[model samples]
Target: MKTKFKIIIGLLFFSLTTFAQKDQVKILKKIYAKEIITDADLVDYKKNATKYGDVAIEEEDKVYSEFYKSILPILEINALGANVTTMQKANFINMETISDLSSGLNGTLDFEKKTGKKLYTDKINETIRNFKPIFWEYVVVLDGQKKYKEVSQAAYLIYQLDKKDLERLYIAAEYALRAKEYDKSIQYYNELNALKYTGESTTYIAKSKVNDEYNAFSSLAERDIAVKIGTHTDPKIEKTPSRTGSIYKNIVESYIAKNDIPGAKKAIVDARLTNPDDTSLILTEANLYLKTEDFDTYKKLITEVLAKNPNDADLFFNLGVISSKSKDGQAEAEKNYLKAIQIDPKYRNAYINLAVLKLEGETKLLDQMNKLGTSPADSKKYDVLKAKREGLYKSALPYLEKAEELFTGDADIKSTLLNVYNALDMTEKAKALKAKK
Candidate 1:
């Protein structure tokens, strides 16, 4: 009697567990079968679906489910077109999740157009009416896929939706730049500048496990909780610097591209005032002077930078490049180039430029040789010039060889070295280089 009672209790428990599983499945199926034609219907269905167990619809289904819910409101709005407010449109616009609708919406419109059930323009208007959060979310998704033009369009739409959201204009400027809409980018940037917008924000970050680099969290509380829970390490609250300098710098660059030198100069001065200690602003000013052939000012500004950053090899290289542009400045050019090399022994560009400086006289000598007539005097002169040319080749050889050794993968260096080798009749070296090629 005791054994039978125990068996009966075990079977009853098993039957109850099996019945509960079956009931959950039945509830999930019933929820899926209901036609969710309105947002209210969806809300009811979601409540029922989650009542018995935690059930998530497929991601694609969730997207289309939201689309199905929008249909009734969209049709009603079209029927009662004049009665709707922009706020109503904005609300519905933010209701639908349209990210993963790669082809469904367009296909539906095409079908409607073909059947004459709905005009194409009406469908387009409906889409435009319900365009906000769709466009907003798509901007992020499109940016991730590197679809710059689409991102630009979406960002512009968001800007249209809320002109008061200056951050949207900022984002529009960025995507416009990426999409190569330079004029549009400049327009947006200028507007931000007029508004005196300095885009600065504080971010909560912690070091990531994969790269050990700081990854930002959505909020300070989240970051602190993650750190406290030992999920992330190296918690930090970082304040982003202002974008005023960069905004002005971008304006200056666009102006330079347009060859509006005066505009660039004016913007660069403002940029420097915005960030007085920015080294890049100083460089920009120097480059502007270099562009206008004001070498005196270029050298003075560069000297100022070198005084502050005496160990910078690239600064010395810039001085060398500037001096080498003039015939009388070759000596100074060589001295600065050598100084750059002394600071950074592996400076490939300095080596290449030094070789180039040594070879500069070859062109003049060749010109003089070509102009000479084929007389006995010309022949004697030719021999002297030939000897000088050979000496020039010898002078440049060491620097070229060193540059080649340092940057074997550099095509410019390889081409220059090959030409020098052939000119000097370095048969074995030329052959070796050809074999490598």
Candidate 2:
């Protein structure tokens, strides 16, 4: 009877031990089989990590051990130093997949499990902050090495990780642009813009100093005094932390790059409806017109902008270029160029272009003179014409000299200056320029 009882106890204990081992094996298999970690798994792990203390540690160790074993061959292959093949690259990406899973597991197991603790909150925030940079670094490396498939896989994983992270979306868009995936890039940028407009936080109104001085009047003196004691604060000035304009610009540029003119125009029009007075968007529209060679519309739009903000020297310079495209536009070009110079004295292109217009005028006059007859009557006419041509050259000489001074190494400017000196009979200066060349 005693022998039979011992045998029965032994059988029961063996069965129970076998059952526990099988359960542990099943847990490990589930972890090892995961190719991509989902949010639900993260949430479940968070619950388990908090609820099951030492049991969670034991299971986590088993999962991590299985992961390490699976990636061991890849780690060794990568250690072979610089002669990695496509198969090896694919293996590395597989390892990254496992690492991402490990990160999700560890993040939940270590930090998110302790939800209410300050230390847990801080550590989780730091982990979240570090996650993006690390993932982006990997993506950039794969891209630089031209491991395109790996990049695609990594980018997809990142997007899956956080659809709301605008920085991640931006990086994805940039990678897509690099990969010549314009449509995908546009899609990501659009998503980013949508998220930005829909989210809300806070707005604070505060007075800030526009200058260090304030205009004040003393009643006793009945005179205005410039008080320079403290900052001059303005209540009317308001500022907001916004990135919508830049996002709009990116979307427009991507559309333009894909040769989708209608799409780009639609984006610009939509952005304009929201930000009607935005000069940057207006400039983008003007640039689109310039790209399409619709100079009339470009000129009209820019003219309207100048009417609002006429002090933009670059706008004046651009107007000069547009005017030069029209027939009989030299005078208008000169006027615009002069205005640019008046606004910005050191404007190099303005000086160069003014000189070029003067030279063009001289060339036209000389062409007419060459067409004159060789008779005595025409000879007198030729003399008058010669004087006029010389006067034009003289008018161009100062502007050319200024341009030459501003850009000493410009061969075209130097050559033009040399021609002007020769026409004006400044023989010594012309000889000097010839020697310099």
Candidate 3:
């Protein structure tokens, strides 16, 4: 009889577990079916406020917040085991919310245009704020389940809903990049580039002033004077969005990450085609050539760019680098380095290179001095050579000191500066630098 009772107990426990799972699944489905807040819903809430009073109206207005809350349980359920049907249902819910919010935001914007009043601004902003957190939660859930394609899709939806939201666009592009969906990432980055040029315009409506009529009837003929004061008649002004240049850089990087050098080149070309006069894009193209080791192309491109904008310090610095790398370019390198420093006094790289060039010259002079014999006549010659070498070393002092001041934590710079200090007989400064590390 005891054995029979144990069997019955086990069967009851199994039945309870099965029923619990079914109930959880039912809740998940119900959450998915919850209606998303729409423009019409907002309108209804406003229209019915008088009939419903403040409490009922407030409850009705919590539709979006409530919907987001409803999905949390399903997200929790999916985190454990993640039933396929439940996951699909959650994605559907996300898609629906994205679509509804996007449509509602557009409609609200249109209403503002017509009414000249920001009626739904706060509501839309609140909904977006609520949606963003929950949207990220869904992304985490999908990403944890290794549903990368779904994650990208959700990210793309968020971007479409608010193209002006650069953070969302960047997240979408990064997700696509991580999934090896290079084409998708490129598309998103291109969209970002397009939207970057079309900046948001803000409009403000000014209130009109009222006029009062004053009459004096003391004389035979009464005269009425109309006075208008504190009236605002200024027209609404719209400010265009500022142009941003980093999107092209992002696109090029995405292409390079996929080992598509030609694609990166083409992206720069396309950006230039649109923004021919954009110096930043031209500089980006120059950098692309430099990265690929096409020195000739980089030089030619930068030369053309410099002709247009010669005051650019970075361009002068790049020219200095190119000159420094050439076979017989000491003089040219020095000229370019000096030019860069003249344009920007705080140019640390220019200072470092100038100092290194002087140091190299001093080192060669020292080598020649060391090669001299130890005879009395040779000793006299060595003294002259050593004096010349010391002068050359001293020439590097100002630049090296400036470089050290500009960048304190660089070990290479500090080491080079220490060498310079020792060569110039500045023992105190060298000891101080050595004590730092």
Candidate 4:
């Protein structure tokens, strides 16, 4: 009967030991395998390394071992990660000597477990503090070269970051890019861009597009790959951070690139905060509106600048360009061009433009002959001026004839001069221009 009682006691002890090990193991495995963790994990991972005040060598060993067992594989991973980072490496290496501590703990635990010693609660607590299994998962996945690892790391990093860390998200993007997970990197980059954290919005968007192009180009090889993927057109991105006084500038550039002149102007108007004393922004705003044929904003902004500075050649030029672009542009275009000439007589474009305008009507080419006055006559010049002043050879022939004096041997001008003669109702001159060649 006594022997039977002792056998029961031994069996009960064995069962208790088995249950204890299994319970701890199950707890960890469940937390790890499911890959879901609680806030407590984050809190513990952030727990201080200097928690035990003046710990003895044996106590420190006990503490390290306990942390290793309870933390699963996360603590060492973080230390390595922190160490690998900028300047964090120097501090991390000198901070606590992680490798030795971890090894000592594991070795001590193995020894203790073999001898059937009681498991300490402090280690479990430390492990609980050292939460962040993604850290370990990252190492494992990277070490094993798992395809999903980089994307997974990026997602976790994004989740872990708060407001202050939006910029650091670039690191996660690097991993995602390296993994060929272009979409995920874009997500992070786009998020950062949206936060207005750094650089121009279009800048980041441009970078993203470059990455997309590289990726698409790498995957395919065809002459029309750009046209095929429509990769030539950049995908739109949300507004991002801006440089001081450059928000509107950036938006304008983005619109130009997208070929949305009207949209670009609208963005400028919407975000139009300009220097108070300077109406340059107003002039810019007007020019953009004029490009879109939005006459109201164009007149309003340009007029405002002109009112401030009447002699403003830029505003006059702006008005001239707008006038010329209008449907009934002839009259207003002539008026603005003259005004520009009056303001800056030496404005080279005004002289050239006036020369052009005279030939548009039934005016003589010699009317504004003084503008092209005396360029040692060349067919190249004649041809260039001829093409530029099309539809009015009556006013252009004299200049062409005069210019042909120097470049009589030039085939291009000689050919154009013949056409000018035909328009000028001078059949004899046309014949003469052709006959010379």
Candidate 5:
């Protein structure tokens, strides 16, 4: 008889517990169905539902997750507009709209974590998957707009979602550099270096039937599919060169921009060890030495570079530029500039610079001429200096004219040529240049 009474009590407890669980599910369903559900509301519901034990909490979480999943589309439509394109065709969206949608999705993710259920897993995953490429498209548009900070943000989003694509991280770093966010750029670049991302790949391309233009596909499979379809033809594969050298080069440049000379020196040393064959890296080192006023080392490095790349006219011209910085470097500057002109006969800037270098010699003569008195000896000296000045102008005239001939569109060349002509008393040429202006 006592055992029978104990069985009766257990049955009563089971019935009451079942009733409470059902009651919790019912109440939470009403709460989740409200016109506006907040985080606090969800928290309160979860707390109340947990009082009825695991079964009640599971039912509430399942219901609440489903409710969130259903409302997500509405939130997206509202944030993105009713006419928003499909995921594949996502275009420029302002940050406000993106933030709104991101907030909703993040909240859903949070909800899933708190609930410990797999109720809406697939849908949320699909949405996140779509977000990566959409953010890439946004990055492209933002970069064109020179909204570099936004580009960094969008690229970082892509990186977070798909860390395997180091290109996205690289894009983030580059844009961060452009945005002058040095620390962020350094951090991203460090991550890339640690990952040893070489940025080498094969690109599959096909000619589009619609525009007769070549379009690159994301993958070989996609390219093959496009080729199998009638919309594309003449598929080809192109190998993209590794950007390893440039990555290190930019890191050094960022360090230099931050005025951290020692850091720059260390970075350049490390970078050269990684990519010694990259002449651009050598040029960067030469530039760093130039910045630190280590002229001997700068010239030595540049000369070394010129030996390896003898046919590079720009290197010769750059050497000329470096030499031109000192009062004693005229002959060296003139020699380098002449060598540059010889290599590229139509090198317009070299001609202009050589002319400027020649014209620079007149400064001392003019200074002496300006300090002269009206005495006969001073007058004689003045005449000699004046004649020398005319001779200098005469010598510079050919280069100025050649520069103007090579490129008729450069304002600096035109301005310099006009001044030279005026100084040399070449009235007809001066008037003609003025008329053109």
Candidate 6:
């Protein structure tokens, strides 16, 4: 009998204990909510409010959620710590009344653009009309006369709730970011930061499980820092080099980094104007056009230059190149190359260019070889003449190789020939020739 009685008592105690336990925040809310609330609990709330100011807030479907979660709790906790006023009370009532009224707002929202359906056509909007005012039970009336929750409701409600809850602030910040209200998000993040919430600064902080570096830059802070640094001039990097091309390149780089393609092109043009002798700049502009796949512009630049200096080796070389790439005029290409070589007697590029042209016309090279002769003595004279035909290489080896071929029998020419042969990867032939010598 004694054992059974003890068990029953124990069960009763356990049940009571289980039922007695409550969420601290909810408990505080109920306690402060009542008049003549315990002074001990009020004192506790004071300490907590001082230690942790406003709590984190998030989006709430109900209108009273922010008021209940943020404004009410913060205001109430602060009021309990100090003085509560009628005006302050009125403000709280007004807020809560507005909240309930807004909460009751139920309507479908639709949007229309002049052009009809668009991406944001189905967006939601809140609307309510009418309000009513009451003492403790806050409410606001809109337009034609209806009452709803007012500020006093929020204030008094906050006064009753615990001020330390923080989970909502993160939600608030996230929603702010979604709404493109970065500045407001930053404010919330900053509030969290002030409380020493490490993860408040980072977008991924919400998923933080353990030890991680605290990110201090909220989206707003990040933007602000960019603005701050952006507004301030860095005289060092900004200093234009004495070389006109260098300055021009730097300007182009800056404009490009800012995603101003036109600005970058303009800088190149300006630089060309500043240093008309800098052929590289002109080439740069043409290359820039080519890079942007603006082949028309590229042609314009080179063509304009060619009009002024038809004999320009670089221009002719590029024109011939574009022509060949386009497969438009091989015959004209050969002619221009020949002219470039004629204009510049020692033009090595002209020779290389003409040699490339011969890749498609291998048989044409025989005609060039015929110009040399069938015999060794004739070969010598022929090779020398071949060397003079840099531009004529519609299919032929250029001057240097031709020169080397002519000197093939002479000791100096033989040595030069051997080196040239080695350079051309005919090492075995070069070795055989050396051995024969």
Task: Report the number of the highest-TM-score candidate.
Answer: 5
TM-score of each: 0.62, 0.60, 0.54, 0.32, 0.74, 0.28
Instruction: Name the top lDDT candidate.
Output: 5
Q: How far is candidate 2 from the true structure (C-alpha RMSD, Å)?
A: 12.9
Q: Write the per-residue lDDT of candidate 4 for residues 1-437, one digit (tens) a residue.
A: 99999999999987775564445444434443344455565344333222221231355344443543434334433434333453333232211233333444455455556666646434533542453233334334443665554544534343342235443354455455556555555465545546654554432122124455422222223324554565554422345544423434444544655567766666566556434444655655666766677886787788888888999875776677667766778678767777886887656555445545555644443334435645566545655555544546555554455446755676765766676666656788777767785
Error of 5 at 189 (Å): 1.2
Per-residue lDDT for 52-123 in model 5, tens only? 345434545444444443333333333443456755244334554455445545555667678776655566
lDDT of 2 by residue, 1-437 (tens): 99999999999987775565456545434533454444554444433333333233354444433433433333344344456564555444443653554455354445435543342234334534544455566677788898764575567566655545555556666666667777877887787766655222333232325644333442312221112333434312223546566667777887899999999999999988978887877888898888899989998899988988999999999989989989988788889999998999889889888877776667677888899998999899899988988888887888888888777878988988887897889999988777773
Q: Scored by Cα lDDT, where does model 4 land?
A: 0.52
| TM-score of structure candidate 5 | 0.74
TM-score, candidate 6, is 0.28
In model 2, state the lDDT of residue 355.
Answer: 75
Instruction: Report clashes for each candidate as comma-separated counts.
Output: 0, 0, 0, 7, 0, 52
Clash pairs, candidate 5, are none
| Candidate 5 or 2, higher lDDT | 5
lDDT of 5 at 284: 90
Q: How does each model score on lDDT?
A: 0.72, 0.66, 0.67, 0.52, 0.78, 0.48
How do the candidates rank by TM-score, highest first?
5, 1, 2, 3, 4, 6
Candidate 6's residue-wise lDDT over 245-325, tens digit each?
543454455455456688778878777776786655666777777767776788788877776667787677676666666
Clashing pairs for model 4 are 44-129, 45-129, 65-105, 66-123, 71-127, 196-241, 365-395
Expressed as tens digits, the lDDT of each residue in 4-35 for candidate 3 is: 99999989986775565445434433433445
Taking the tens digit of each residue's C-alpha lDDT, what string does model 1 give over 286-374? 88888889998999999988888888899899999999997699999999999999999999989989999999889999998888889
